[model samples]
Target: MNIQNPNRCFLGVSASVTGRSWADRLDARGAQTALAIAQRHGVPDLLARIVAGRGVALDEVPQYLDPSIRALMPDPDSLTDMGAAVDRLASAVLKGESVAVFGDYDVDGATSTALLVSLLRTAGLDPLFHIPDRIFEGYGPNVGAIEQLAARGVTLLVTVDCGTTSVETLAAARRLGLDVVVIDHHLPGDTLPEVTALVNANRQDDLSQLGHLCAAGVVFMTLVGLSRRLRDLGHWTADRPAPDLLQSLDLVALGTVADVVPLRGLNRAYVSKGLIALRRRQRLGLTALMDVARLDGPPRPCHLGFLLGPRINAGGRIGDAALGTRLLLTDDPMEAKRIAAELDRLNTERQEVERAVLEAAEAEALAATGLEDAGASIVVSGEGWHPGIVGLVAARLKERFNRPAFAIAFNGETGTGSARSIPGVDIGKAVHGAVEAGLLVKGGGHAMAAGLTVERRRLGDLRAYLEGQLAASVETARADRALAIDGALTAGGATVALVEQVAKAGPFGSGNPEP
Candidate 1:
C-alpha cells in the first residue's frame, strides 16, 4: 500500500497477527533517494522506492539493477591463500595426481563438489569425491574418510563447505600424507588447521570482505584462479580447451540460493547471471530434477531453494549421501533421471519426518515457554527424533517464536542438535563459545545457522548458558524486528506491468528481502 509520507507507519497498526509491527522501510533520506532514482532513471515511483529501500545509491542503481559477474567479481588472488591453493591444485592437475574432493551433504557442498569434479575431469583428471552421511558420519571431514582417501592413493584433498573447524580431521589427513586445500566459507576457530592452503573468507586473518559468498561461490573463485594458473602454464592445447566457466554458474546459483547465503554484491551477480545459465537447462541432472519437481517456465530463486534444492538435499538428509553429487556429475541422462526420481521420493519422505518432528518440537517449545513470549532462546530435545530433521525444526522454531532456537535429537547419552538464529544474533559464535566452554562436544557454522554435538545430561546447562550469553542480544534483535514495507499498493495498483517492474530488483532472499 502506498503511504504519502514514508516516515509514518503503514495503516498505523501497533502490532499485527504475527506479533510484528508494520513500518515504512524508507525514512526521510531514503524517500529522497527514491525520488532521485525516479527522476534520474525515469522509472516508476514504486520501483524507485523498492530499490532505494534496499539502500541502493543513485550512482549504484545501474549496476545494482543489472549485476554482471565481470563487473562485480573481485580478483581471485585477493582472497587469502588463493595463490597457494591455486598453485597446489595446478600442480596436481599438471602431474595427473589422484585428487579427492570432500564435501558436506547439503546443497552447497554437493554443488561445490560437482563444480570441482567437473572442472578437474575436463582437465583430464577423474577426481574422486566423498559426501559424508548425515546419520553415520554427521557433518564435515572425518578421520576415517580422510584415511580411506589417502589409502586409495590420493595425495591432494580439497574440502568444500566444511573443514574450517575440522582441525583434528585435517591433521589426520596431513599425517596420512595428504596436502589439504580447504575451500569453505564457515567461521573458523582461533587455531587454524594445518593444511597447504585453507581458503576461507570468514577466517579471522582474511582481508577479503567476500564473506557473504557461499561455498560454491568460493569454489567458483578458486576455479577462476586455477584456470588462470593452468593457462599460464600452457595447459590448454588443441586436444584440450578451457572449460566454459559460465556453464558452471548454474551450480553456483543453485548452491548459493539453497545454502541461504545473502544475495548481495558478488553473490547477487552470481545468482543473477547463474539464473540465466540455469534457464538454458544444459545440465542434464537439473533437467531431470526440474521435470520431477514439475517446475514450469523459467526457474527462479524460489524454484531452486524450495523445489530442486530440497530434493537434492533429501538424498543427503535421509537417503544415500552421495546421490546429490552423483546426480550433478553424471553424464548419462538415464542415470540422471534415476537419481532425480530417487531424490524426489526421499524428499517426500523427508517432509513427513520433518512434520512429525516439528510437531513434537513445537509442543515442547510451547510447554517450556507456557504460552508467554519465548525465552531468549528455545532448546528442545526428544528421544528418537531424527537428527537429519532437527535443523529444519530449529528453523521452524526460530521463525515461529522470532528467537534463536535449537532442536536436539537425543539417542541415549549423546545428542545431535541444530540451531537457527534471528537477525543481529550470531548463532555460530554462540555455538563456538559453548564448545570452548566444554558444554558442547563440537559445533560450528555461520551467522544464521549451526550444528553441534552435546551430552544428554548437559542439555539443560547448554540451554542456560545460551540464554545467558544471548539474552540481551536476542532482546535487542526482537525489539527491532518489524515488517519493512517499502511502499503500499492498492488493489488496482497491483498490475501485471507493476509486478514486471519489481522483477528488475530481484533474485531476492536472505539479506536482500523482497520488497
Candidate 2:
C-alpha cells in the first residue's frame, strides 16, 4: 500500500518496461468499477477495490480469500490413473507387502516422502523410505536404488516427486519383480515407463486443473483416493477417524512453496489449511524447525520459501538431503531438536558458500563479455565449485541479469549444473537441447528451472549452446524486468485491515502470484 521503495528503482503502475503494466491497468479499471459497486452494495470501498483488482468476481469473493478444502478441491477420481493407483496401493496394504517410498532430495520430495510414508503407515502398511543422495544417487529413481530395495525384500515401490523420467530405473524394478507406483509432478516425456501405475497431474492427457501442484500436493490427492477406496472396501471403518489430511497439509504447504508452484485452487486451499496446521505445532520436527529458525507466528508462504525451505534444502545441497527428511518424519522431540539445530548450522554454511559462488560467477560473466558489462543472460562455470550451491547461484544470476542463467561446478571428469530462467524462455528445453547435442550426459526440468550433468571438457560447449539459444530471449526478458505497482496509495490504504483484505487474494506464488 505504501507502493514505493525508496532504495529500489520504482517503476510506476502501467509502466511500459515490465509486462506487469497490464496488471496495473487492469487494477485501475477494476478499482473504478469497485467504487461504483461499493456505493451500490454499501460495502467497504477498500475491500471492494482490493477484491476487484485481484479479479475476484462477486461470486468468488466468499471463497477466494477463505480457502475451504471441501469447496476448492477437485474429486480425486478426476485424476487419470488415480483410482488404479489407489486400488493397487490399498491391495498392497491389505496383503501386508513390504513397501518402499523413493523420493528426490529437494524440499518437495522430502515432504512428499514424509507425507506418503506417514499416510501409508497409518493405513496399516509398513513402509520403508529412501531419499536419493544428491551427489551419489544423482536425482530421481536409480537402478542401484531399485536393486537395494529389492534386496531388502521391498515388494512394492512407491516413488514420490521423481520417477516419471526414470525409464531405466523402472525397467530395472520390473526386472526384479518390484511393482512401482509413481506419483510425481514433473512433466513426462513422449515415452512412458512401464510401471504398476503412474499418477501425475502434469501428464499431457491428465486434465485435473491441478497441474500446478507440487509433489506433496500430488501425494495428498493420492491419499484422498486411497482413503476413499479403503472406505468403500471396508478396510477402514467410519469411526476409525479420517486420515487427518489436514495434519499433513503443513508438509504440502512447504513443498508447494519450495517447488515454486502456482498457489491457486487446491494449492491455495492446502497452503491456507497447512499454515494453520503448522501453527498448531503437532509435528515435533516442524515445531523444532520453527523454533530453530526463530519463527513464532503461523508459517507464511514467504517463510517456507525464503527461511525454512532453504535450511531444509541446505542439508541436501552440501550434506545429506535425507537428514532433512528424517527430521520432518521423526517423532522424538529431542532427536528433532538436534536435527533442526544441525540443519540450521548447515544452512548458515550454505549461505556463505552461495555468496562465494555468486561472486565468482558474476566475475566470470563480466570477463566473458570482455567489456566488464555482461548482457541479460549469465552462464558461468568454475572448477571445484560446489555442486549443491550451483542451483542457488543460478537463481541469483537470473535475478541479477533478469534473464535465464546456468551455473556449473566441475570436478575432474563430471560437471553438475543447475539453471534458472525467466518467464518466457524454457530452461527445460535448453537442457533437453544440450542433451540432444551430445553436450550433456543427462538433463531435465520444468520451464523455470532445470538440472544437467556434463563432462567437464564440454563446459565451454554448454555455455555457447545456452548463449546461442538465449540470444533473442534475453533481449526480450531484459526489456521486461521493471516492477509495476498496482496503484498509488495514501497512508490510509497501508493499514493492517487493508493488508488483510489484500491477503484474501493469496496464497500467492508463481502463476497465481499476488498483484
Candidate 3:
C-alpha cells in the first residue's frame, strides 16, 4: 500500500472526496450472482451487477427494477385503525360535514394535506385545511388552532404527517366533540392519542415494516382505504366513482423524496409509479411549479428533493405556512403560478438565512476538533439563530464532519433546533432519549432527523447528554466505515447509454444509496 494519494480511490475510476481509495478494501465480486442473473435476463453485465450490489435478489430483480403499485401495494387495513380512519373519513365526506385537515409545515406535511384536500374536493366535499405557522405553532397541532377549527363548524378533523404525538391536543379535540382521524408515519409514543382513529405505519406494534413510508405514502394508502370502504358501502354511485389513487402519485413521490425516506419496498413502487404520473404532468399545480422552477424536463427525484421541495418548504420556513399546500392543492393555474413565484423568492431568502447559520456553525464545528472531548456528534448553538434553517445547518455540519449533528438556536428564553444524522446513528432516538431524560422540553422524530425545544439554561446538559449517548455508536460506525465501490469505468467509456443503464439502479436516497 505504498500509494501516494491514500485518499483517492485508484480503481481506474472516481476516488473519494478526500482523495482516498477504498478500492483495495472493496469486494468487487460481492455480487457473484450478478453474472448469472445477467446471462439469464439477457441484460447488460453492468446492470445485473449494479442490481445485485444493491442487494436485490435474482428473483426480485424484475419487480425491483419495474416497481408496480399493483404488485407492491400493501393492504391498508393491515395497519392499526386504518379501517376506522377510512370509515370516519367516508362518513364525513358522505354527510357533507365541515371537515378540517391539519398538517405540519414541512414538504411532507404540505403534500399530505394537499393530497387529502384534492381527494375531499373530488368527493364533492369542500375541506377546510390548516398548515400551522412554523414560527407560531411549531410542529403538530396546537390547542388554539383546534378550537378555531372547531368553532368554524368542523365536525371532523384529520391530521396528516403529524398528530401522532399530540396526545394532549387530540384529547382536547375529543372534549370538543370533534371526531379526529390521525394519519401519520412518525414513530408513535406510548399510549396513543385518543382520536377517532390513529392510523400510523410506524405504530410501535405494527408488523407491516412500512416504517420506511413517508407521510404522503401513508396518506395515499388512507385514500385507497377510504375509497374501497366507500365503494363497499355503495357510497360511490355510477356518477361518483372512486377517486383514482394513481393520479395522486405525483404528490406522494414529491413528499417521499423531499422527506428523504429510503426508496425501498412499497416506497420504491410509490416513487416509480409517482414518477410516471409526474411525467404526465396532469396536475396543474405541478406543471406551474415546474415552469417556475425552470425544469424543462421530466421531473426526477433530484428535482423533487433539491429543486422543488426547497421552494415548497421555503413558505414554511420564512413566508406563509400554507403557501405550499395551496400551491399543490389548487386547480387554478393562475393561483399556482402566483404561489410558485412567491415560493421561489422565499427559497432564495432561505438560502441566505441558511448560509448565515452554516458559517457560524462551521466555525463552532471546526473549533470543537481542538477540544479535549470533541465527542462523536457536532453540536453548535448561537443566539439569534433562526429555527427554520437549523436542520439545514445540522446537515451541513454532518456532511463536513461525516457524523451526526445538531444545531440549537437560542431565542433568549427558549432554544429550538433540528438534528441530522448519518446512516448508523439514529438521531431521532437520541432526541427522544434526551426528551425522556427531561433534558429537552419536547421532541420526537424518525431515524435520520428530529426537532426539539429546550430551556436556554439547560442547553449545556442536553449537549453533554447527546454527546455521551451517541459517542459509542458514532465511534463504532466510524471505526467500521468502509466505502464499497460498485464497479469502475474509464472516462471515455462512460457513454450516454451507460449513464442510463447505471441510473436504472437508482431512486436512491438515505437507506438505498446510489451505487
Candidate 4:
C-alpha cells in the first residue's frame, strides 16, 4: 500500500526540519513471504503480502479474510470474573429484582449501556439506567448516584465502560445492600472496587490479553456469558428466546471503532459483522442518523467514527446525557428520527466548540517549553475551557505533536484533564501512578488514552511528575518511528485488483493501523 503524506508535524513544529529526512524502509523478505503465502492461499500476490506482512498466519488467511465473529469469538468464560457477573444478572432477572445500567457519556459508554439494556428487556426484564452528566458527574460511578439508584429500588447496578476505579462509589453501594457488577475495560487503581463481580480484562490478576477490547466489547462478552448461563438455567423458554447477541454487533462495532481500540481478532469480527448490520439499515435511529449525515453510500468505519458516533456522543456531551442510549434502544422510528436530528444539531455544535478549544490549546501547546522545541511531551491547562471538548483538543494536539498530550479544563479549584498518548508511552499508567501518589484526585485508563482529576495547584507537580516518568519512553518511541512500506513493484503490476486485495487488511485503527 502507498504511504500517505510523510514528514508530518512533531510537537507543533514542522517535521521537515532543515536536514531531517523520514526513515522509510521496505522489507524484501516480508514481501517474498507474502508472495508465498498468497500462492498457498490461492490469492493475488499483492494482497497476500500485505496480510502476511501484518503477521497473519498462512493457515488463518481465509478466516481473516472473512472476519467472521464465530471464528474470532472466544469463550466468554475466558474473561476473569465473567461467570460471577453473569450469575448476578441472572439472579436479578429470576428474582424480579430491579437493575440499573450506569454508563459514561461517551459513545462506548452509551453503546455498552444500550446493549445490556436491550438484552435485559428482551429477556423479560425491565431495566433502569443512568448516563452521568459529563460536566456534573465527570467519569465513572459516584456514591451519590449509587444511593439514588438504591432508593429507586434498583437492586443490581451494572456499570459498563466505567467503575473500575470507583472504590468510594462501590463501597457506598455495598453499604446500602446494592449489588454492583463492573464490566469495564479501564485499568484498575491500587485496588479494585468491592462489587458483586468485577469483569475487566485489564484487572491486575486477569491474564486475558483482551484488554484491547472497548467497554462495549466487554459488555457484549458479558451477554455471551449471561446467555450460556441462562441457557443452563432453563431461562430460555420456547416463548422467550435467548437474546441473539449477534444482533448487537452493530453497537459493539460502533463503540469499538469510536473508542479507537485495536481492531484485531475479536474486534475485527465485531466490526466486520457490525458493518454488515449497519448497512442493513435495521436500526431506525442509525438510519435516521445516516440520512441526516447525507451518507448516500455504504457505511464504512470512517462513517461510524466521524459521523454516527459523534452525533450520539453529542447528546451525552452537550445535550441530554441519556439521549444516546434512548436513541439506540428506541423502537419508535419517529422518536428515533427526532432524537437523531437533535443529536445531529448537537454534533455540529460540538464541532464548533472543539475547533475553538483546539485553536487555543494549539497556541498553548506551541508555547510550552520543550514541547514546541522537540520536548518529550505536551501538557496544557487552561481556565474555563469546555470539559466536553478538552478530550477532542487533546486528540488534535496528539496528532500535531506526535506524542502524548494532556488538555485540562479548569473549573475553579479543580481541573478535569483528558490525555492521549502515543504507542509506547503509557499515559494511563502514569495517571494511575499520579493517583496513587496522591497527586491526582482520580485517574485511570489504557495505554493510548486516560483521564485525570487534579487540583489547579497540582498542575505543575503533575506536569513535572509526568515529564520525569515519560521522558525516557518518549525518546525511545520517537527514535523508533519509521515508515513501513510493503515493497516495490513494477508499473504493470499495479492494478485495481491489487489495490482491492490490500484493502482486505482493513477496517484499520489503533492496533491495526493501515498498512
Identify the leading candidate in terms of TM-score: 1
lDDT of each: 0.92, 0.81, 0.84, 0.85
Task: Estimate the overall C-alpha local distance difference test score of candidate 2.
Answer: 0.81
Off by over 4 Å in 1: 1-7, 16-19
Expressed as tens digits, the lDDT of each residue in 210-233 for candidate 4 is 988999999999998888888899
RMSD of 2: 4.0
Which ranges in model 3 have alpha carbons more than 4 Å from their true place?
1-19, 24-29, 370-373, 490-493
lDDT of 4 at 441: 87
Q: Which scores greater on TM-score, model 1 or model 3?
A: 1
Count residue pairs with overlapping backbones in model 4: 2
Q: Model 4: which ten-residue window has the lowest total lDDT?
A: 1-10
Error of model 4, residue 21, in angstroms: 5.3
| Residue 223's lDDT in candidate 4 | 91
Please identify model 4 stretches exceeding 4 Å from their true place: 1-29, 370-374, 488-494
Order the numbered candidates by TM-score, best leading.
1, 3, 4, 2
TM-score of each: 0.97, 0.90, 0.94, 0.93
lDDT (Cα, tens digit) per residue for candidate 3, span 1-515: 11223343435544467644464222335346888678877677777867776677778888888788888888998888888988888889889999999998999999999999888888889899999988788999898999999999999999999998899989999898899999998877666898889888788877777888989999999999888888888878879877778989999999999999988878888887888999998888788888888999877788999988999999998999999999998879899889999999999999999998899898887886733346788889999998888988998888777788889888888988899988778888888888778988888889889999989888878878988889898877665444555667789878999888777766776566777
The reply for model 2, stretches above 4 Å from the true place, is 1-58, 238-241, 370-376, 512-515
Candidate 2 per-residue lDDT, tens place, 42-100, comes to 45665566556556666666676688889988898888789889988999978988999
